[model samples]
Target: MEISARNSIKGTVKKIVHGSVNTEIILEVASGVELVSIITKSSAENLGLVEGKQAYAVIKSSDVMLAVE
Candidate 1:
């Protein structure tokens, strides 16, 4: 499939936390770096994301905020 998002990282599924409606997916993009994303539980189930599974993190955001203390 074609996507406009340029930031696509190949990562492995580290963990999956399922909530009532939304599910949190933790993907290890790099050796020690991880990216987290929240999607609908139905989507998660449709993808069949399990621990140690290989997946890609497609980042297509309009705005990103960062804070430092």
Candidate 2:
């Protein structure tokens, strides 16, 4: 798929958590690294996301803030 985002990371779906309105997707980008994303339940179903499915995490943002406590 073609996308405008430059930070697209390819990974495999590791885990899925379904909520009433949203679904949490955990993608393993590296051997020990993962990214979590929350998307609409319908969208997740439409995409047919399941464990072991390959996906891309396309990040498009103007600013990313980091905080440490």
Q: Which candidate's lDDT is highest?
A: 2
Look at candidate 1 and tell me the lDDT of residue 23. 97
Candidate 1 lDDT, tens digit per residue, 1-69? 578899899999999999999999999988999999999999999999999999999988899999999
Per-prediction TM-score, please? Answer: 0.88, 0.94
Instruction: Give lDDT: candidate 2, residue 16.
Output: 99
lDDT of 2 by residue, 15-68 (tens): 999999999999999999999999999999999999999999999999999999
lDDT of 1: 0.95
Best by TM-score: 2
What TM-score does prediction 2 earn?
0.94
